[model samples]
Target: MRAVVIESPKQLHVTTLPDPTPGPGDVVVRVAGVGLCGTDVHMLAGEFGPTVYPVVPGHEFSGEIVAVGSEVQGYAEGDRVAADPAVYCGSCHFCAIGRGNLCEKWGTIGITMDGACAEYVKVPAANLYRLPQGVDLGHAPLIEPLSTIVHGLDVVAPSVGDHFLIYGAGTMGLLYLQTARRNGAASVSVVDLNADRLAVAEQLGADHVATSADELDRVTTGWEVVVDCTGAVPAIEDAFTRVRRGGTFQQFGCAPDQEQARFSPFRIYNDEIRIVGSMAILHSYGRALDLLAKGWIDSDTMITHRFGLDEYQKALDTFSQGTGRKIQIVPSLAPGA
Candidate 1:
């Protein structure tokens, strides 16, 4: 087997390794494609706290089951699936309360364990969700990130006619826009630093797009729901101010640990604003898969680039440069072939 290993922060290698064998409760998936996301970038930089060294960094993936564990049931070889990467310590306080995303010993595949950035990777059978018939395997990786959107919206719990203001026009932001529209948002507006991304947002159903919130038509009271998907302190801070009185604001982005965003505490108290933070996927995996199957996401437009396992570094470079959306690694392909 060939895999890309992040030996440590700032160090990586593509090398041969023994093929993974499934445990009694796990299955080995023959890699199809893995989506490259911001989390993977943070893992490579050692910024993601749960990341373990020498790990294979890829979590958003879809593949065909090649080997099933003896104890696994209701699934078999040749099934196409996507596994939820989140691994939780089931006995933790948070897990006991059914909030495993906040588990004390929370970990994720690709960050803490070996992942699918290779020809084969082992996954817990319990985490796997089979792709619907006729779905493109290459597009299935979007389901993982889409699940995060599902979780975020669950936290927002917006009214059917509420207006939405989202920061960032990248993959996450755009997905949020589409889903918000489908979820009955009165209107979805987006802001981004990139004009190209803003354009994509408009094409994907955003009612308004701007480089800054000041440029958009101001709702008399403010947007009913404000979401920050950039994870940048500036965006987060600005998003807070856009929330209408008594409205909700969601921090859906993954911000750096050392950064802080400023907000008016008095305003929150006086306006009765609701502030919520959405972490990774909770119990939304199946919902996300179902949403994708129902055609809620434009997977064709979301995925923009693909690379082989050997081109992992180049894929990282492209992702960092914001050259494309939803870049993926098809482990079975040869480099530059």
Candidate 2:
């Protein structure tokens, strides 16, 4: 089987590898589509802490099950599914307390193990969520990322009429916009440096879009819910100031490990503001899949580009350039296939 291997920091290649076979409790998925995001970018550059060299880097994906482990039950070959990439130790303190997202030994599929950026990849059977036969496989990859958005909302626990101001109009931001609308937000405002991304935010039900929060016409107190989806220091700093008194601020993006942002501690105390950080998927994958099946998200508009396994580098380049929404790699095809 052909796979993309990150041999070391600043090095990557699409090369052939032995086909993966399922373990007693795992299943082998014939890769259909895998989405690329900032985490993959960081992993490629050796910036993600959990990632090791000579690994395949792709986690947001979905495909058909070609082989099932001997112990797998209630699933069989030809079943279309998406697997949660999050791997955690069941005995960790966080996991014991139902916070597996912060498990002491937390790891993810692409970041910590060989992932679905190949013709076939192995996944724990318990992590697989079946997709409806009617759904398009190309768009199924969005479910994994969307699940993170779901978890973010769960962390915020915002009121139905709360106004939202989200930083970044990238894929995660756009998903946040759509989900906020569905969650009964009084208004959803999106901010991004990219005008094209703002336009897409508008198309996806954002009540307002702008390059900066200063350009938005909101109350002097600011939005009831503020979210940072850029993982950018500047964006996170700006987003922190947009939360209204007694409102909530969510760090939903994967910021660089070494960066820091400034916030008014006095204001947080006086205004009763709550600041929370949402990690990766946490028991939300199934809910996200159900939402996708219910048409809560516009998957068609969310995905903007496609590449094959052989074009993984090109896909990563486009991602680094910040040129598209959800870019995907279909491991079974060539560049334009």
| Tens-digit per-residue lDDT, 162-237, candidate 1 | 9999999889999999999999999999999999998899889899999988888874569999999988898898
lDDT of each: 0.91, 0.90
RMSD of candidate 2 to the truth, in angstroms, is 1.1
- Which regions of candidate 2 fall more than 4 Å away from where they truly are? none
TM-score of each: 0.97, 0.97
Q: Write the per-residue lDDT of candidate 2 for residues 236-333, one digit (tens) a residue.
A: 98898889999999999988676789999999999999999998899899999889989999988998899988888899899888898999998877
State the lDDT at 9 in candidate 2: 82
Off by over 4 Å in 1: none
lDDT at 201 for candidate 2? 93
C-alpha lDDT of residue 271 in model 2: 93
